[model samples]
Target chain A: MISFDLRIDRRGFSFDVSGQFDEGVTAVFGPSGAGKTTLLNCLAGSMRPDSGSIEIDGENVYSSADGIWVRPEKRRIGTVYQDGALFPHLSVRRNIDFGWKLVPAEQRRLDPLEIVELLGLSDLLERMPSELSGGERQRVAIARALAISPRLFLLDEPLASLDVARKGSILNYLKRVHDEFKIPMVYVSHSVTEVVSIASHAMLIRDGSVLGFDRPSALLLTAALDGSSVERFENILHGVVGESTDQLTTIEIDRISISTRHQNKNPGEKVVVSLGANQIILAPSEPNQLSARNVLKGRVKEIWSSNGKVFAEVDVGPEIIVELTESALNELGISVRSDVFLIFKSSSVDVFDA
Target chain B: MSSDASIIVLSFQIALVATGVTLPVGMLIAWLLARKQFHGKFALDVFVSLPLALPPVVVGYALLWLVGTHSWFGSLGESVFGSTLAFTWIAAALAAAVVSLPLVVRSFTAALAGVDPRLEVAARGLGSGSFRTFFTITLPLAYRGVIAGALLGFVRALSEFGATIVVAGNIPGRTQTIPAAIFTRISAGDSDAAWRLTIVSILLGVMALATHNWLLKLSSTVSRDSSEVG
Candidate 1:
């Protein structure tokens, strides 16, 4: 467990936040300039807080009352930045070895080769950081951080620099690392889809303060209700490849199957699919002769309105959020527990290897 | 060795020793100035840079006052070495180091400053101490600039004249460096010898400066490529 109550006053902005994060992945979610990165820095011991204390696993790393502070090197916490920050002078192999060699033999738990393989960096070992793509650099950064076997992992928008496809790929890698290593992580991001997909617990920050803290879905719902979330929401689903034809591929999710544009994946392979909330069309009854594919009957489990737009949660095998304008919501007369059909084109669904 | 050969060798020795001593010390001061924010920073900066702005003769006079036989530093040297440092080859090297320090510091400061502090932060996060990070990450990345700075300092030390002449008087076989020897030869109407030494000095200066420029070009290209991709 990690906990902190920190207050730092800058020239024009002040950051004051206090929260306790549990063992699983807890995402610090907020908009840009909301002091999320500052909080991460304070926790990593890179930036000192003007007041209060920070404790990790019941050990006091910093305390104003006690006048105790630990240097960043001794903190045993690893941070991955958005830009990768790989040493430009070193090759990927040396970069991964950098932290691994620093840890004493008895203290080393994870092998460097395991981490390298886990991040799929075997081919790029001899290459310099400049030679790798953005996603590849991030993978190397993650491997470098994990080599030390840190007590806590702090990721600051690790995927913010990646494209949509690369983001999904790295997200899967991160999930596997978390599951395999069992190291607690504090993920910082502004994307609701990323937070909801990876984080078990979420803390909402706004204007240098904690807005709410709870499960990611609950906190995001609260954020939406308060009109704080202005970005478009995304629905992420996991499934296995079922059947493939020349035109389309079917992915089985829970009891229902979703067909997407032809994907070059073998049968029985797991894949993740992402669809924007606005991409979904809701109809009161089944419409005949529609060009769109993959229509499923579902019930409106919940409904809410924010920022002059209406959002409804429909339970079709898996819960998917749909966004509609106020006029459309009123025209459909959709209410909670109403039967509806969720219709979307196969081209709208983005599939990635799981 | 011939007198001219001895003078050239002595000049090379003094310049090499001066550059060797100033390299590490200049790097330390340059790093401190580049990466730190502390009290008296401006004063420290100005003091290190004073030699660049003040007349070389004035700097020599100040050194003479500080390390002359009557002064405490001079007496301490006398007690340790059984002699004073004034009017010796070592004094010439000392004068050269002082005159060339600011140029070294300026080059080193720019070099170290060009490195991304985030890389250092990343190193610290990876369990490397601050000192280790400096050696492993910061130093390796800025090595081209460091070498260029050292070469610049060496060239400045090689051409040092006014300060060396005052502190270490011209003694043909012992303390006479190229510049002092050239001055002596010119005064004695040895125009041929003066012209020969002048050509040699210009050749050495051009070589050092060309190498410095080449290394700078390479460093800039590498940095540009990395930044474009990064």
Candidate 2:
């Protein structure tokens, strides 16, 4: 676990934040100038907090009261910056080894070759940072950070600078790294899509204060999937596989069973499912003989109206948020506390090992 | 050695020694001016550039006051070397270093400032301490500008006459550099020897300036390339 309670006032901005990030990826999401980078820097030992302390895995890294502060190098916190900040003077191999060599032999958790292979950097090892593309540079930067065997990994918008195509590829690499390393990471980004894609938990920040912190699904169901922002449609739901068939698999969340496309997971295996809010359809009653495979009944918990569209949350065992036009909502005449059917195709859900 | 040959060799030696001494000191001052924040920073900046604004003779006098025989440092020099610092080849090199140090510091400061401070921060983030970052990252990135500055200082020292004549005096085959020997030749009414020395001085100055300009060009190109990569 990593926790920090920091207060800082600098350059026309005041930030006060306190939170704990347990094992796994805890994404810090906020709009621009929302103290996201400042928070990350404070934890990384780059920005000094005016008051309070920081601890990683129960060890104090910074304490304003005791005048104790571990330097960035000794903090054992690895960082992957937005610009990929690879040493331009060094080759890819040398850049990765730069941190690897500094780690003492007894504490080294990763082999140099394994990281190179994991990040697909074996072919580019002899190339300089200048010769690589944006995605390639970020890959090398991640490899360099992992080589250090840090106690906590801090990533400050590692994909914010990449184009859409590169962003997709890099996100896949990040997922692979997340699965391989099992190291706790603090990822900061403005994109809800990126956050939902990798982060298991999400912390929402606005105007320098944390507005919300919880599992991404809960956070998204409340404030994000209101169709107010199209980006938040990517909501992650956690579940475990109940039964499997050739065409579909039954994943259970709480008391609900969600049928998704076959995801190569055996029964009783834990999984996380990604369901886009726009893909889900809501009905006033149970729809029979519909093309969609999965349909569950629940009461409308809440409804939000904006820009001629309606976003409703239906608590079908687990809350299923969906978006529809104002005309469709009026035609169905569904309101809060009204029983409704939540419907989506089996193939609409994307499942991954949790 | 011939009189002209001895003057040229002595000038080269004095220039070399001056450059070697100026490099580390100038870089330190440059780094301070470029990266550090302190209370007396503006005062130190003005003090470093003092020699550039003042006449070389005035700078030589200031050095004399600080290191001449009557001063404590001069007595200490006497105790250490069994001779006063003034009127020696060592004094000439010191005068050269003092006169050209401002140029070196200025060039170095400009170069060091051009480097992105974020790169150093990234280095520190990647487990390098401040000291290691200077040698491994900061120094390498800023080396081209530093080399150009050193070359500029070397040429300035090689051509220094006002400060050397005041502090070291004209002692042929011992303290007389190319510029000092030229002064002596002209004062002794040997116009032909003076003309020969003048030609050599112009040639050396042209070569030094060309080399310095070349280094500056190389630094710019390298900086552009590295920035592209970074």
Candidate 2 B-chain TM-score: 0.94
| Model 1 steric clash pairs | none
Candidate 1 residue-wise lDDT at A145: 91
Off by over 4 Å in 2: A221-301, A304-311, A314-334, A337-354
Q: Pick the candidate with the highest lDDT.
A: 1
| Per-residue C-alpha lDDT of model 2 across residues B1-230, encoded as one tens digit per residue | 24788889999999999999999999999999999999999999999899999998998888777777788889998899898888889999999999999999999998898777877877777788888889888888788888889988998999998888888888988899988888888888998999998999899889888988897788889778877665
Worst 10 residues of 1 chain A by lDDT: A224-233
TM-score leader: 1
Q: What would the DockQ be for model 2?
A: 0.43
Q: What is the lDDT of residue B136 in candidate 2?
A: 83
How big is the positional error of residue B178 in model 2, measured in Å on the Cα after superposition? 1.6
Native contact fraction, candidates in order: 0.79, 0.51
lDDT for B138 (candidate 2): 84
Model 1: runs farther than 4 Å from truth? A236-241, A251-257, A261-274, A282-291, A294-302, A314-319, A327-343, A347-354, B69-75, B78-84
**Over the stretch A171-281, how does candidate 2's per-residue lDDT look in tens digits?**
778888878988898999887766776787888877788878888756765455333333555556779898888888899998989888776668888777778778888
